[model samples]
Target: MIKFESENVQKFAEACVDANSIDELLAGFNHLEADATDCKTWGITPAEWMDAIKAATAEKIRIWASENECPELLKAIAIWKNCPLEEVEIGGEGDIAAGNKWLDDDGLITFYRWNAATYGEAK
Candidate 1:
């Protein structure tokens, strides 16, 4: 049976990936599974697995977003100020090139300016 109220659902899911039946799964951490492939012992279903995956992914996104308080654009600006990039022209005919660096281009940290086509990933 799935250890209900377990916060380490992702770890459990990972361990159970190769299990042919619930018997191979853990009751907790110490207890081994019985030889019998009892369906009742399997607490999680395919649907529940999907749900768990979705929840885990969403939670990761939330955590990542929270941790990345400094946006890419700001980081690029800081790079420009701290470590000056090599002679990469500030602008080309009022063109926007390096601005896209925050998302795609490698010029984000090194380049001084860009012919901004759009506001980059950072504000």
Candidate 2:
């Protein structure tokens, strides 16, 4: 998991994860980018900040999946983390079906796909 030394950075990361849309996330990024002092204080470039935010979002999702004991979600997280299939305890076909339903219902399939494509090895 990525850790931010600055509280402001941490808060921004959390807000990004909670954001409902890409536009909202972009707005947050723009706001941060405009604050040169805060950016300098964090001691990271814009690219590094974006990387940190992505890491933080993934970490937050992983934590949520673990807390909820959602195997499908955990599997997705494992894929995003690029862990070997054997390392992730995915349930049977029924679990997979349910997981697919959950992902569709929550409109998270695209989010997972985008996240994995952006940060993990291609399938």
Candidate 3:
């Protein structure tokens, strides 16, 4: 196990909550690891780090499900829970895409969609 500051751990937790991608979470964790302490008492293993990230993601999903209208967030919850997006319980009569867009007027759906539009699809 590697050691780090308790403050690093707290910052890691906060970053995980806001991380919308695996890359972002790992980047934050790596940055924190650079300043770790020299004793086991403050060190955390990679597995523990991954577990913290998962917990943060789950907590975010729970909060989003309870208080958000964006279907993308709902879909994130559904995917996190391993359930069908259709069964995630959004209060709307429209299809998933429509409901998503209804709430935000621009639900990008996935990273692929964002990249596609941002960079243009290949011919």
Candidate 4:
């Protein structure tokens, strides 16, 4: 059962990855799953999980825009700065190389990057 509201959980998950800290990123993913489980307890489906991931990833793009003072992240996700939200995969070689010091290359944070290509469970 997802505890946090869908929107809130997604936003926080995105923030977890955007944050320049591995601890923060892990916390974010953990929170996201917990939140989803809370929702699942009430009967959220795999489709909902996909939706949440997309929404959360899009939220990260918004945060990136506001924080970076640029649209690089948004561009990476192919979202317009002032328009309906859109989601895109994030992370790549650069994000992967930034592991531990940041988080694993496949960490949600890295996977949340605009061009992120691959992802897997954190084990």
Candidate 5:
């Protein structure tokens, strides 16, 4: 179990309204963890932190889904839930060229193509 400061928990809790489903809720939940772990920032891990975070995520998702009119947030949440962190590139633009090379090496879909797919445009 991990512990989070009340103040930090509040920030993630507040963001729940922006989440539309359980999945979205969890993403926003884990986003907090990622933020905390970011060396450029600060974070707190509450006792039994993981469980508490999951519970918080679930509650927030339920509240947001019921209160907000948009279901897309839920879908976004689903996508976030299944995200492969190992496949994610965490750095900035400075890594673009190398990232591109890695993508080619991996035979993975390019961001351009992904954007096109999102917009229903053929790439």
Candidate 6:
């Protein structure tokens, strides 16, 4: 489970995880914006809030991939994050090296891979 120092950020992150669409996530952010003073009191800046949200979203994706036994997706995430496969904590039976080799051989450019790379490093 992901943990945040700020309670407001923690609640916001949970709301983000339950959100069904971008609009819902935006609404949650708006709610947080309304409580900016409370966030500041907890020493959380807007940037940190965004970072926590991203981390929570990434974790949700990671959990989905793990539960679905989708190692390819996990590999794509790791590749995009530029993180070593072993560090991703992907709980499955897939061979990480072979998956990496296949991804390289296929020269795949998926949304997850592209977007993950486009964004900052994984948390």
Q: List the residue pairs that clash in candidate 6.
A: none
Expressed as tens digits, the lDDT of each residue in 1-123 for candidate 2 is 446776667766665566534334434443545345535766656766675555444444444444554545555545654665445442332122222332321233344445546657312
TM-score of 6: 0.44
How accurate locally is residue 81 in candidate 1, as Cα lDDT from 0 to 100? 46
Task: For candidate 6, give the lDDT of residue 103.
Answer: 29
Please, what is the TM-score per model? 0.28, 0.37, 0.32, 0.31, 0.28, 0.44
Backbone clashes under 3 angstroms, per model? 5, 0, 3, 13, 12, 0
Model 6, which residues run further than 4 Å from truth?
21-44, 71-89, 92-111, 115-123
In model 4, which regions exceed 4 Å deviation?
1-39, 70-123
Rate residue 115 of model 1 by lDDT. Answer: 16
Scored by CA lDDT, what does every candidate get? 0.33, 0.47, 0.43, 0.39, 0.37, 0.49
lDDT of 6 by residue, 1-123 (tens): 358776767876676667644334334444545346534654567777665555454545444444554556556556665767665444442222323343221122233335445654322
Q: Write the per-residue lDDT of candidate 3 for residues 1-123, one digit (tens) a residue.
A: 112255655556565567555334435444545323322433555555654554454344334334545656555535544566776554333223322232221222232233335446310
Model 5 residue 22 distance off true place after TM-score fit, in angstroms: 2.0
Write the number of the candidate with greater TM-score, choosing between 5 and 6.
6
Per-residue alpha-carbon lDDT of candidate 5 for residues 1-123, written as tens digits (9 for 90 to 100): 113456555454444334445445445444555443422222545433343445454444233334542334333323333443333332222121222233221122233234235655421
CA shift of 63, model 1, Å: 0.8
State the displacement of the C-alpha of residue 5, model 6, in Å, after optimal TM-score superposition.
1.0
Model 4: per-residue lDDT, tens digit, 1-123? 123466645554454446534334334444545455535553555555444444444344334434443245434333311222233322332221121132232333444542433222111
Looking at model 4, residue 3 earns an lDDT score of 34
Q: Better model by TM-score, 2 or 4? A: 2
Off by over 4 Å in 1: 1-42, 73-123
Stretches of candidate 3 off by over 4 Å are 1-42, 70-86, 90-123
Q: What is candidate 5's CA lDDT for residue 71?
A: 35
In angstroms, the error of model 4 at 107 is 19
Better of 2 and 3 by TM-score: 2
Q: Pick the candidate with the highest lDDT.
A: 6
